[model samples]
Target: MEARLKKTECVKQAPLAQILPPVILGGAGFSYQVYPDPNISQVRQVLRQAFNLGLRAIDTSPYYEPSEELIGQAISEPDFANRYPRDQYIIMTKVGRLGADRFDYSPSWVRCSVNRSLERLHVDYLDVVFCHDIEYVTEEAALDAIGILLEFVREGKVRYIGASSYRIDLLLQLAQSVLDRYGRPLDVVQNWAQMTLQNNRLETDGLKNFRDLGISCVCNASPLTLGLLRSNGVPVGSLGDFHPAPAALRTAALRAADYVAEQGESLAALALRYAIWRARATSTSDFQVSTITGIGSTKELDENISAISQILLPTHGSPINSARVERDAPLWNKVQEILGSWLNFNFTSPEANWDVQQQKFVKLKL
Candidate 1:
């Protein structure tokens, strides 16, 4: 399978620094939560399967016990590493949390985290490193964290730096802070995004604002939300820590699933296509995924790639793919409620060029 993929044009090229890579394919929380206590070989197969499917980016954090090590073990295999250029695939890892000591944003911890991550992943440098779970860290601590990330940039141990799980205002503030102090804006921003509207803050403001600033974003929790949109709702265990699925959210998800199924499409396909398609349609550089459990084998990879390609192709006045349109309803309203005023910003434009007017000046047209 790897040999056959090596001979194919699996990777589609776009601006590297400008456009975030699509299909990131995450690894954490899979074996433990998604698949129970799986063996090392099973974990290795999952990682290799994701790679074989042309997923170039993989997001992991120290919080997910041994995920980084598992990935390292899988990729270290000669057959896998030889199949893809290490640089061709983006390796994004996070810092700030050590054991149960809480998420630390200080320079000391940042440096320590990077070194430890390198040791675990068996890599010399990282494609991108983000400050994870900044919501719990203080403002000063956040700045200090970014400062340490900058140190890594100077040392060339990290190619770019970003912030994860930060609100729209904080993301914008951090970008400005980076520019003012370092003379450059953030290279990437990691946020929660999905098809069925689990998090509207990203769509209404966060996502648009990031694009306006020329910052690429990697979508976390992209698929599990599909389960949220499913009748059973995405289990809280599946969504990680922040903003677990509530009963209200599950109810909404079931409605979305029922509606999508009525339109003759599967709910899972809708979620995957929606997460990527909307990100590209919005011109926010690129979209990313953490896990491609739905897309592991060569056959599944081919099908998913086709689904993505079909979603992007023109279909006349249709706003989305038939499958997408059928699978789910827009959750923008519910999202706004959850995110509140945080969604108030001027990022949505006429779609000519991805220009976002700053908040202070751009009046809310909505």
Candidate 2:
């Protein structure tokens, strides 16, 4: 049996000074909820391959059941330790949101979650920790969670603090509120499915808002819109019927997928290429941008890396490939055309409403 490696010392850096790769490995795919019967060997292989390819940052959550544990187990292996040290990569996980309908942002839960994540990731300190799905919680609770995270920072349990949400309006409100209350901007903010080919609101509506508040890193997650943009359609089975996108958007996605297939290109790849290119094109020095993609297998990891390489060139002048841009333009335009009314549409998520005075999410009306 291989020996488990002891936790190595990590040199802490300022939150803003830490750099994330153009792509982060999203860990939701590692859970049984997302991928049935996840193989530990495969997970270990994917982690090593991703690190070797320069995609070292990982984003997971307790909400992702067993993901953090699996990742912790993988990295603890002696071979993994021999290849990659703790400080060489980044590990980002979330707290607050537990089950789909459950959330806890109280200070006690915040501290507990942080300590639990530290143990599960097998690290003495986390590079980044997000208050997962802040929009679902009340404004006051979210603020309290951030305060606790700030306390953790002082204690050396965490290096950076952030919040992840699907609602652009709510995210902006939270960032501004944090700045006003804490006198410091969130080190990072993450929004999923908003920066994909079908929706560009994170760029169109969010960039300036976040920049105004001095937020440093903006993560564009779920470039495939949580599997909706793929030819196979929205993910079913263990992921449950949890996709919040409406029927109209799903139908339009199907049409767009079919159109892209007819053109001998994958809608999923086109979407990823567009996302990677857009992130590079829109990123500024003050507000660095990156994308997070879930890789269930080494094959998916390779595909994501290929997409990143194809879009991000080696040239110093511009990271984007003008040739690839010109080639994909028509296909992208046609996909948008197919989307039509569904273009840039924002879907409603569960518990979308929040009552500021009550300090909790108001149950959605049927």
Candidate 3:
């Protein structure tokens, strides 16, 4: 999961910083999964390669516990510092949420967190900052914190403001609330694990509302459904601990993974392409989506990049993975057919009253 996908390797990497990528290098895996690996040096190598391959932007947060520091150390190396520079790339971080299951949405915490992130990231300003895990806090608190973020923007501390969540419906409400208070919508949002091959809730429920609320773009994280949709199935015991997916859904996902293997397709590969295409495909109401997938190593990066390349090119006449045929219609159909019962299934928020949060966002609408 490590080789970075350069513009030349994939379909000519679009250089428009103003435009989001079909895929973004996510930080959760690097920070959580790969961080404690005995070989710390490998992490640096992966970061360097990812950047060289045109993954110019990075997404991290304090809640990731030292992800910001790890990223800072990698990029501050003489070669990376001189080559990429601060403005040449994007550094996206989040505030308002602390350790796992802990959150603080106060303006004071927001201000302090942003300043702390600047120090951790070794930068004066962040390119993008989100009110991390807003679903845990009330919507009023989220709006107040978002207002504080805008103040940082006015001070040039961050360029764009976003909110990350598992609840797409709440995210849409928060976006509209931002508009109601200031006559402007959220610049971006990161919705996780909900737009995968098995789940399309973001597209079916979140996007149209977002478009009307004037949200500029959406970032889909955990396209592998936070490792639930992978070939190996959910990691060790991640199912019940942090994830909210109930036992019934978990059993169904395992069954689907087994079925996918029997179909002679790597679930991971097919799932990645499905998400990338789903994000890139235009919505009926003009909602745009960008993907943020985490890779643990250069090897994973190569697989992901090659998957994107395969889907971008035609079914034939390419040196990419032959397994990733240009035509994915049958695979899509089979996935829907096999995992039909699990499609569009979502879990209840384990934290906070969802209606309370939604009401706040709803009231914020203009």
RMSD for each model, in Å, please? 9.7, 3.9, 6.8
Model 2, range 285-334, lDDT digits (tens) per residue? Answer: 55678888988889888877887788888665788899999999999999
- What TM-score, to 2 decimals, does candidate 1 have? 0.72
Positional deviation of 262 in candidate 2, in angstroms?
A: 1.7
Every model's TM-score: 0.72, 0.92, 0.83
Per-residue lDDT of 203-240 in model 3, one digit per residue for the tens? 78887777777776788998888777766656532223
RMSD of candidate 3 to the truth, in angstroms, is: 6.8
Q: Rank the candidates by TM-score, best first.
A: 2, 3, 1
Q: Which candidate should be chosen as best, given TM-score against the real structure?
A: 2
Q: Candidate 3: which pairs clash?
A: 1-297, 1-299, 1-300, 1-301, 2-297, 2-298, 2-299, 2-300, 2-301, 3-298
Worst ten-residue run, lDDT, model 3? 1-10
Model 3 bad stretches (over 4 Å) = 1-17, 33-40, 236-241, 283-287, 313-326, 351-366
Lowest summed-lDDT stretch of 10 residues in model 2? 1-10
